[model samples]
Target chain A: MVSLKQLDLTDLSVRQVNEYLHGELLEERPAGVEILNPDGLHSIAAGLDTEVEIDILGHAGYFIAGMNQRARVTIHGNVGWSVAENMMSGVVRVKGHASECAGASGHGGLLVIEGDASSRCGISLKGTEIVVGGSVGHFSAFMAQAGTLVVCGDAGPNLGDSLYEATIYVRGSIHSFGADAQEEEMQADDFEKVAELLSRAEMNYDAREFKRVSSARSLYHWNADAHQEY
Target chain B: MCGIVGLLARRSDYRDDLGKLVTPMLDCMATRGPDSAGLALFRSPLETTSRRFALYAANIEYDWQSLADRCQRELDTQASLTFVENHAALVSPVAVNTFKAWLKKTAPEVHLLSVGQSIEIYKDEGHPEEIARRFHFSEMAGTHAVGHTRMATESAVSPAHAHPFTAGEDFCLVHNGSLSNPYSVRRKLESLGIAFETDNDTEAGCRFLEWRMREGDTLETAIEVAQAELDGFYTFLMATADKMVLVRDAFACKPAVVAETDDYVAVSSEFRSLAHLPDIKHAHVYEPAPEQIYSWSV
Candidate 1:
């Protein structure tokens, strides 16, 4: 297993560090790579395709682990923009707050933000599972495709705008739905699924306390012509 | 700096009259970039091999002939020098590897932009349709093609500064946005004594592709590296002889949409350009993911 010491970044540029993490040291990163100072370095561990594990000690920057194929990245500090953006597969754990577009256009995999998540948290999420422990910013889950987003705290304005096929669950109040999304009663099966996902991420939560939100069956379906006004 | 459009036949499924089908599509992206325009077409009626290269310079200088000559000599085995012009050429029996190796040994400071099969470029400054008329871009045809419209930010306005910038024989690129940091990268490219033709970020992009390909990166990987390292907002498209690659910036500040059918795929800066397709009603249209790459093969 590749065991990168945190001190190894003394001389390497951000690109070099990413190249080493995603390119050369990927296969050997079974034991995981430990980053000492992950302070705002954009594109860290991006596009990784191995089953490697990366531990960032501090805040990270935009598009970190973008297009991730099969890597597990954990951030200890707050992350800037687009954490795990456009992820194809794999897992990303943000211990602190997350900025805008947290999982934008993700096709698959799971994202867990332990703290507050900013606006457009799961914008255009395509088959991704996102769980935010704290509140979220405006337009969260905008234009989401097919996936599941779970927010433990309050959601901001225009939640689930232009939502496609994704499902959302929130323990706190939502300002409003953007287009056709609406709140629904949580079912037994949905509670079970949410509980399982939260358990997998080891988050402290009870699925029973949350309500489910989803499309009103109005937009994007082949024959559904009824449009919902903002 | 430019807009690029192309047709990549899933199974050579584009219309029999490919040229006739491509002209109007290329004409749509005029506002994005409009400095100068050109088109390169290739066909394999019997057995044809194509190679595409996108080169980036480490630095901007007055001359690139030595680098070009080195490229010509290094890639002699794969290319027969079918045609030569100010920036690029058309070669028969395009050699992908030979060109790649030459890039590594010679233009290590440059970036290898792209590598693939058949390439056609339509570039100029003006509205897309206006540039098309000026270049007579409709005359060229291929199963796969890429076009660019320029809104110059860093480079001087000229055909040389235009998009669909070529690296070797068959690769070209069209870009939008600026590279925030060009000094260090340009210095490195010039360290190899590589000369540059234009003062545009797009040229730097071409050099970067060349540099990456030389480093043994696939055209796709090279372009990805460019997207990662280069700074600022970028929503650009690239075409090689064999494939088309698109990259959006970190936040995807710019807009790009992709419409795909079983038989066709179209990309544009806005959705309106795609609304004109015959199968537009049936195709699935979506915006490309930010900081992502979408590829199509010819």
Candidate 2:
């Protein structure tokens, strides 16, 4: 049987809970940590470097699971801004909607939002794999260096602005693309990648329905002849 | 950063518990803004001929009865006042111009917070929790209320600079982000011979909206104009006697979440502040989209 421990926030502050998560849990090695009554408090389960499965039972506040390492955390309710921001290597899944900047600046991780994600989702993303079951808001994947953002639903305006290397696959409509981001035909490898990510995210989208968006490479060089007119 | 919170109960059954329901929401947002706090409570409109004047003083022990007596003597009118700490709500049949002239001459030190048939404001410079307790926020009752906890970035940290900035009658506005074009907005309003009390950016937006309303533009129309004219980031929560309105900038650099149920509609800069509301578990919660105007009428 998996050892399950409950951390009820009614009697514990987030500081106390995090202290326990950071200190004793490493030694105790509980198989799972269940955080009860999160009630939209910020920074729950942040910086966890364990392989334990964590469950937050209520709506969580900003920066939850931020900078996560090895933990596989799941939030049962909605989350505030910057969820999983600056993550290293981990898997964080939000069952409900996420506020702005979800999975922002992550180095490595799989962040899944089953519901809609607000503006700037995966912003400045570096090598993170984000699969959204629902739509993504405006300016998503802006200035991304390297990653894969798969959207099963519509992509908002200015999607993947100033992109480099990172590939975006959208199964739904793209309202508009950013300056250097344009759509291309999905090849065999692209279908395989989208299928793998969708399977990991537990989404049911057919991989062939996805379209690829990548950099046009126009912004890579500075043009001295043009007088700043795009 | 600053915090903005507003609550409007849908049914009149919840009207008497408005303060109890909203005080904690205001207190929880102290993390976002801890320097000063203010609230504008909109009671049901009074059917009488008199208006209520919300007043504030720097010193908590200031003599309010003497000032009231002198006002009654000078204006030869009957007025009644209730004071708690440094704040008071005076009710009388006096015209706004007459009251302003009398206050300028007799009690220039006391600050006039708001004047309306329903709106009563209480604000001070301190920790929001302490100030909320001092003003007896939990005991007051109203149909709706708009509150703010301010962390001043572009202006002084004084009571006058605290949020829930009011202009004209029952209208008040609170902001979470800074405005970059306040000077130009202020310049245009000032050119029309309009006066200003503090050099706060939110006051500029508040006065501009009220001026537009006075010029026969509806509140929605005024906000549409503001969307075009106002620049910079903002998540503004505004209230009049019967309406609670919210809006965000086009970029939505700031954040606002709203929770609505059959009982009430609540708004905050973040969802954390609204965690403890009754029946919140089943409320339909969502973030207000960028550049959208959301209004709830009582």
Candidate 3:
């Protein structure tokens, strides 16, 4: 059986809550922890390094669960900007929609958004796999260095701009693709990768309908003749 | 960074709570922008024949009553002025253009913030809560409203730099990003005989829309043209007498979220601004597409 702990945010300030979660209190590493009444305040559960599960009961504000390591942080309601930014490992799930820069610049982790994600989702991602069950706004996966991003719904304009080694999979329409990001054929192996991602995110969708987007490789090497294309 | 919020009531029951609802939304984004705050409220027109115009005074003790009395005697129409802090709203039984011409000739010092049948604009350089408290926004009622909190990326922090810049009668706009080519755009509009009140890029964009509308373009066409011409990262929340318009640039660097329910429609720079709105949980929340104009009319 897993151990459970509860922290009520209404009675505590954000700093106090963060201090308690970051200090020796969580050193025992409870299996699951519950945070109540977040009320959309900012910086909840930020910079957490524990390998425990944290469940935020209500809406969260900006930078929630940012720079995480080996912890599963879940928000039951909507999330504000940069949810799970620069996470090194583990999972961060938002049950509702996310605002801008969701899962931005993460080095390693699986960030699952059950609902739509706003603009700049997974911006400058580095080795993080972001799976969105719904659509994503513009500039998703912008200048991503590595990892994979799967959008089950439509992607807004300028998806995967200046992409570097990162892969994008979209099941629905794409408004427009950014520079150096182009469509690629989804082979059988690509389907397997997308299937594994969907199962890991616990979302149900048809992977066969997804289109793959990756860098054109033309921008990696600088050539004087290619200046106009840039 | 800046924050913009707009609320339009789809039902009559929500009209009375417009200001009350928008105040909290503006306050939620207080941290994003700390330089200044402003709002444009659209109340229902009174039963009388007078049109409403909101004016700004250079000082708090400006003689607004004398101006009203003089305008009433000279224009030969019933006129009234209600003072609020450094601003006042004038109601007069005269044509808008005629009244504006008279004011320009007589009271050169007074600045016209807005002139319409229902719109009243209040803005100042301060915290969002302080500005709202001084204007008594929580006690006012309206059918629709737009609020802006400024971070002052492009201009000096002053009352003239506050947002919800009026373009045409009952039309105003609030923006949340900087423009790269506002001076050239301003020059182009100036050559077309459009006057500017401030050097802010948002005012240039607002006047561009007004100029396009005057050239026989619809609001949608004007926005589409703006998308092709304006070079910047912006998320704009614009309002007319009966409609609210939302637009993001092609890159969509600036954020905008919209929530719609059976009773009302609200748009904000972030979801936190809309989190406390009534019936928001059940509402359909989504982010608007880049360069696509999303508008709703009552």
Candidate 4:
């Protein structure tokens, strides 16, 4: 039940603060918990099972709110790698650019990166809904098992390299594809998902402009000498 | 440049969370190191006598199976043949001191990486996730774990050129830069029966460390020796069950950042990945000195 604003976190490391507040804020926490300086440290608010409302003011580092079972983390600046990694549940919002693997391997949650994200934004991602207002780096969603990744800007190379069940909607050009990935015309279900994610991110974009990329599931297994086309 | 990551945790810790706590952190570098990714995890009840080998054989041909068979036959008695792939992990129940002697006499072309009880390795020719999905890398759960993501420069993409090259059990490596003077040092290791799988510069680097360690040097000393012997713009990361070593070559061409707190420590190729911590007001980030090697043992 500690508000991040009142917590005297000046004396401890980022990890130390996380350790100190372990399990103290959960399930709709008070709005006072706010981070004053967010440099490239890491794993802030990780393993939080509480529904605490934590607001960060600057750029953050990797695995922010990682493995978060519950809790709401909001960042006002750009974010680094895997912002909401392996999130079992909860909501994370980034007001600026997100580095690579923004929501990678996430299980379930709503992640909003207000700006661009670098490569592999949702790799091995499952059940999570990720929305990016800007472009994504190469090989985004390489092995996405399930869930949805919606990008408002351009996408980088090898989009969905080994895509699984997940669906990706990009408003930009795709660099290429691995053996099992391909670009498909957007459908109703795809439109719905993109619309929902964009709305969750509080973005107002035209869903019709995006294209869907998914797995062809053609070369799932290695034939070695075959064309290796997906 | 390349990025390498490994993990070794108590078995009790594994069943509790299923690698959920660490995989995302490991996957965070997919862009910084987009070429390829690989990881090996080893469980405890680990052996202290096993060795990890990094052979740098000369005149290696496309006939990998034949060469591997020859290696097995030559060191058949002392080296019990286990799984044989492009790379193999062996359990050395024999005395650690005598194991190299047996290898020198049997398969003189073998360059030992390290020796220990349990070992795991994964590598490939694409981005980290590409390699990870190809190998189902995250399935590995052990007390000891290590991973690498490549950005191919001096080496081509091939299985033989992949990392965690075995020289002995429990000793494994993932390198992130290139080596100069490979031919001369490779020839030296080859003279001592260190066989290589590919012409990749990293192979030579791994072999040099193994040879030094075999000559009665500790991991630190061996790495130091290799640092002296090899020339390159490199940053090499090697992991053992109880220790992790980071070696930055002359000029330190690659980027490496290390962050640690009382609870845990994490290292990555960039500063942004570590910026999210709640209390890192002035997150102290620095790079390794050229020709200097840093090691941490748990």
What is candidate 4's DockQ?
Answer: 0.20
Task: Give residue B157's lDDT in candidate 2 (0 to 100).
Answer: 98
Q: Write the per-residue lDDT of candidate 4 for residues B1-298, one digit (tens) a residue.
A: 5665543333354423324433554576676577666665555544454444323233233233454465455545334443322334455445665656765775565444445565556555566665565445555455545666666777676555666665554667777777778999989888988887678887788777777777889989998777778887777777666776787665444656655544334455665544443233343334444466777654
Per-prediction DockQ scores? 0.02, 0.79, 0.48, 0.20
Please provide, for model 3 over A102-199, each residue's C-alpha lDDT reduced to its tens digit, 9 standing for 90 to 100. 99999999999999998889899999999999999888999999999999999988899899998999999999998889999999989999999999
* TM-score of chain B in each prediction: 0.72, 0.99, 0.96, 0.70
Rank by lDDT (best first): 2, 3, 1, 4
Candidate 4 CAPRI assessment class? incorrect
How does model 2 fare in lDDT? 0.93
lDDT of 3 at B220: 88
Candidate models: Cα lDDT each: 0.69, 0.93, 0.89, 0.67
Candidate 4, residue A229: CA error in Å?
A: 6.3
Chain B of candidate 1 versus the native chain B: what TM-score?
0.72
What is the CAPRI rating of model 1's predicted complex?
incorrect
Cα deviation of A63, candidate 2, in Å? 0.7
The worst-scoring run of ten residues by lDDT in candidate 1 chain B lies at: B81-90
Report the lDDT tens digits of candidate 1 across residue range B156-252.
7765576666665466666667777766667778787655666776667777787788789998788778776787777777766567778877656
Error of 3 at B280 (Å): 2.3
Better of 1 and 2 by TM-score: 2
